[model samples]
Target: MVSISNSVKTGITTGTLRRVHHIALNVQDMQASRHFYGTILGLHELKGEEVPKTLIELVAAGKVANFVTPDGTVIDLFGEPELAPPDPDPKRGFTRANHLAFDIAPELFEQAVEVLRENQILIDHGPVTRPTGRGIYFYDPDGFMIEIRCDPMD
Candidate 1:
């Protein structure tokens, strides 16, 4: 008879899974979104290209742009023409109900906040502290919420 260890039984293996590679977002204005993410957030633009014909026909997005964060996280922005932005859900209100969060160093958290303030970005919520970390929330150019958070030991 063969016996399997608990680690193997649970499918736990070292270095089997890597970090997130990218996140894609649909936007209304490619240039405005590009400036907010690439210029203001300090992410580097990799390249620009048209979205696949099938995707453009289906989703109405004609062009796409890619950017990378300092930590190698990728952000893909999609822009569609002639499509009106969806009306806000009454229950969720006007802004985004969900958000993307980025991890930051504790020391850099304050500097990040100052950078946003200097750019005239409004904070939607936080600078609040929790047991796990401190965080702040703000809205992107397209009304999507974003968070920057820091843990003391991280």
Candidate 2:
């Protein structure tokens, strides 16, 4: 984990920044990513009218997309002409900026795991027990790892 300085955590700007607005990731193919995030994961997307005019062209060309999460945060995808290869060996808990995670209702964990298996999505880490609750990990089309888990309340 990257440690934030104590100053940053308690400083004037600490609470000024609200929740995450969005997170942008580079993808190999916009269409495949769309299917993974939208069709499979069932994330609702923002249409052309909601996005910037400049992004309209990229969206039509299947080079860009914006999907809204349950919490109202957005996941923006853009095609990368040249993508770097994944690191063969990564330190534990290090995602190198290509990982995402979200919590689901605890009772639904197993069903979500089943869905991933039925879709032939490879499970990279677990449907194992975490201190927070149950969790599962898998990779997206572009090799970006994603985690769906239960909230701490579970």
Q: Report the number of the highest-lDDT candidate.
A: 2
lDDT of 1 by residue, 16-133 (tens): 7798777888777888888888877887877434333434443344377777777887788878655344654322435444788888899999999988899987688888899899
- What does candidate 1 score on TM? 0.70
List clash counts for every candidate, in order.
0, 0
**Across residues 4-53, which tens digit of lDDT does each residue of candidate 2 receive?**
77676445566888899889988877778889999878898879698768
Index of the highest-TM-score prediction: 2
Q: Which pairs, if any, clash in model 2?
A: none
After superposition, the stretches of candidate 2 with alpha carbons farther than 4 Å from their true spots are 1-12, 84-95, 152-154
- Assess each prediction's global lDDT (C-alpha) against the native: 0.75, 0.80
Give TM-scores for every candidate, taking all chains together and pairing residue i with residue i. Answer: 0.70, 0.80
Where model 1 places Cα greater than 4 Å from the true spot, the runs are 1-17, 48-62, 83-85, 88-97
